[model samples]
Target: MVDADQTFVIVGGGLAGAKAAETLRAEGFTGRVILISDERDHPYERPPLSKGYLLGKEERDSVFVHEPAWYAQNDIELHLGQFVDRIDRAAKTVRYGDDGTLVRYDKLLLVTGAEPRRLDIPGTGLAGVHHLRRLAHAERLKGVLTALGRDNGHLVIAGAGWIGLEVAAAAREYGAEVTVIDPEPTPLHHVLGPELGGVFAELHREHGVRFRFGRRLTEIVGQDGMVLAVRTDDGEEHPAHDVLAAIGAAPRTGLAEAAGLEIADRAHGGGIVVDERLRTCDPDIYAAGDVANFPLALFGTELRVEHWANALNGGPAAARSMLGQDVTYDRIPYFFTDQYDLGMEYSGWAPPGSYDQVVIRGDAGKREFIAFWLSQGRVLAGMNVNVWDVTEGIQKLIRTRTQVDPEALANPHVPLDTLTS
Candidate 1:
């Protein structure tokens, strides 16, 4: 059923959009594939922006998805530094760039991704304030970290989320003093809950990172267009040479909203609503990556995952669906983080209230353990810290929703595969 005349338009140049174009060709579509991105750089993965790249351990070219010649060799139309302003759904045309070049598509895909949520406080426009969503941001931040390290300056981070903590670790590696401020009692409170959040707090503290908990950043005090200090609601000022706003990211659904596509409410994590096949309200259009909110039958809930894994797999799934292939995307939510000496991978979704108890195996004191969240003896989620090659077994336990004895689950002697069996 391949249509030679059909054109598939992908909006956004992030990993999801780029991978979708790759999938289309690999699936033998042979249709006109056009990818438009506002960023001048080619498609790239974002994990390195906070990890190896920020620490200057990896080269700038490592983040890109493919070589520049790949697109040209594949006969895919690559439009860089062009923003698609509007989508005329009735006519199936997208108007993009300054001259408003209109391109018609047989099927449209939105991988528009997300933007970093900005700090509303004053002095955010100062030269030393930064956000880490794009490669450009990381490039600027790398130089800022290096300068801070060279001058023995201080960095004040506004949030203790993944981005904040990762950058804090990277800054420490560069020998910069770091202070993390968060309203929560501990870092990663929402994701790991208080039970395991303390582990990360301890890990950072051991590395000499300061934590200013139970407080909000009221304002960024700057002088002469450079950050001087940060003030907390408690009326205390901390000296800072640079500030990082890692508050989180908001999905970019403006074009989809304008196109009249169904958008999800905040309770379900605001994003464009999509079905199992990743098809939006308008059948001819579909969505993937951080922008799409699709159902996870395993959790019996709708989730809009903003992690790299979601975008990595979701893009290909959406492409197959768009190609009229039978597709049902129900992969378990997975993400990993590397900070200082601790490397962890988490599988399944278990937010604060979803699980009743957290069972831990191995040694939490040694920073090598697997923590499992359970609800009435059913495995909801699992996180393995510095414990290698157990992701497959942990994922199986969650997918099967296996009921196990708490003692056995907590005993490292008992194999994970045995519990599932």
Candidate 2:
């Protein structure tokens, strides 16, 4: 065990950083742990912001990972509303922007997470144009939706990824005319294969959501500093009272890069590279969560996942590695999305063009089914639509790498557990 007086400085107070601190304590590390976060509030769960929280189904307090008392009880110092300016590796200290204070650390964990990718266009700075990344964004959106009731208000979402889709569903449920525009052909095509992506696109379309796929948003039009309409690249104008830019996120790697750490490009977009143990080239500093592009054991590729599950799992893994415990961060990747009463779950890894066959279990038309991506007669990945049990079963199969007959997999009469044997 490390000395109790040793100091550990963790940057960012998001899920990964918070969980790492908690895990450190749980593992008998009674050290001086300080969690520095730029946000004013304590670390809170961000997943619900685009779904239940935005729709007024979940409260702000309920979405928080821990209350103020929990941090105090854990003996973790919470430095809220403080920005980390730079990391001096030679001095082993972090400089803060608030007071120009420098704090030394024996070990540091970089869980800086990510920020929303902004568009460089006119009227993007307008009042009604927003991006859903923080609690403030969700609160602002809720306020706008409340003032402009669904029947009269129109919401135009600039991206068709998970966040945009969830927000579109929430806006539709609130009685607003919603439109989703994306440059990609289908929503979730980058993660889910084209077949499943088509089904997801169809599902959203059937629920009163208008989709303008394969179109780029050129500019936003504003009147008196508030959004009035958005223009597409094809010169089509959408008269939207509110606009949401959900074009995914970019890694918060400025501090790490400035510290001379080795960073690499992500497969989908902007992220930093990390090894299997979530360690950067600078052995003293480690990174995880959304900012990291770590190697996947299942896919044999380095991928970055911006999901709550990844943050929660990867944080502790990186923390353990930081504590001199050589643990391999090789768990099967899993993520879930809740949209308008629909629960979607995905597990395992499926790289692009890796799957040779796909087996559909249950009925997609019924809004409940599991799609399994098979490579070499083994399940590589599985996507569950409102079917949790099937997802749990597929997770096991993926971990075990069990071989199963394709015909039995498609048959609803057969139990999912039978495929494992």
Candidate 3:
């Protein structure tokens, strides 16, 4: 039975952890709640880190999930800048901080999140090299972009993924020169495939963002502890005042791994494996957000989504399940991106090789269109670029698993709701 004596401990101070704590209180759990985070800042959302905040359009204080007073007001024990290195599953305790402070909990939630993948090449420690994952990184880069823009300096980005492209757009808007280098033939190749990926490449190119595709960063050349340029595998040196590594992020699962919890492999997105209830192998331990690989009944697959939407909803779902409430985490995989003038929202899973054909509605050249990824006449995923308020219909199409007619799906006149039926 739920009681006030029980304690719940949450690790990681991101959106998921904060939302989980909020849900616990809303569900009438009068237990002791402790939230530990290595970051000194309060729990915050990450979308702004790469988008509005980086563009200098949003204030720094706006990134925080809740006001500083919210935690204490809610009676949550907020421990900032504390490193939790060990989880003693047998004793239901976790050792944190250099002083080895121990916190006992009846239930533990791991929302440790992910860290940005570092550049393997040399000169990564140079002053001009940057990686964006935290609020601090964004702050540092914001200043760097402003200075680079004023000086008409050049920024070379390694990786053409979401982070790389978003940063590229931000830099361009700041009037700084940008050149994105990636080994893939086109940007976002892994996620959108060549067909739609080309659209992004074209979009970036039109915005004065240079693309050096089919190449990898061999080394970051620097002088006097500051980046000078980057050399690609083709022996071409690109002059760069700054270098941004936007490669990717790996889930933070060291604590979970040390606790002997089941972790998903790379194929499954390399995260702590959780059931539909968001419970790990241990009955008392649950995980959510970017660090969790949970089953998606709608897709018949387990996925670790590193998007804001996943963390936003997954936290509350895990909290309910932890409170012994019925929970099934089957939300459709959803993500959106803003690049230059293009704003895109994607729903469902349609990684390369999963979809047979891509059908488009509206005008691609006009930068207003919706692309549907289909497999055996079934809509696997749908992305609306510059299109608004159709997420519900798109998700319904995916949820119903309807075999949409390609012609009707591509016709702008045909409504999406009719396709689901």
In model 3, the clashing pairs are none
lDDT of 3 by residue, 325-396 (tens): 989999999999998889999999988999899999999999899999999999889999999999999999
Give the alpha-carbon lDDT of every model.
0.96, 0.86, 0.95
The candidate, 1 or 2, that scores higher on TM-score is 1
TM-score of each: 0.99, 0.96, 0.99
Q: CA shift at 206, candidate 3, in angstroms?
A: 0.9
Q: Write the per-residue lDDT of candidate 2 for residues 114-188, one digit (tens) a residue.
A: 999998888888988888999988999888777666347888998888999988888877778888998888888
Model 2, residue 329: displacement in angstroms? 0.8
RMSD of each: 0.7, 1.6, 0.7
Candidate 2's TM-score: 0.96
- Pitting candidate 1 against candidate 3, the one with the higher lDDT is 1
* After superposition, candidate 3 runs with Cα above 4 Å error: none
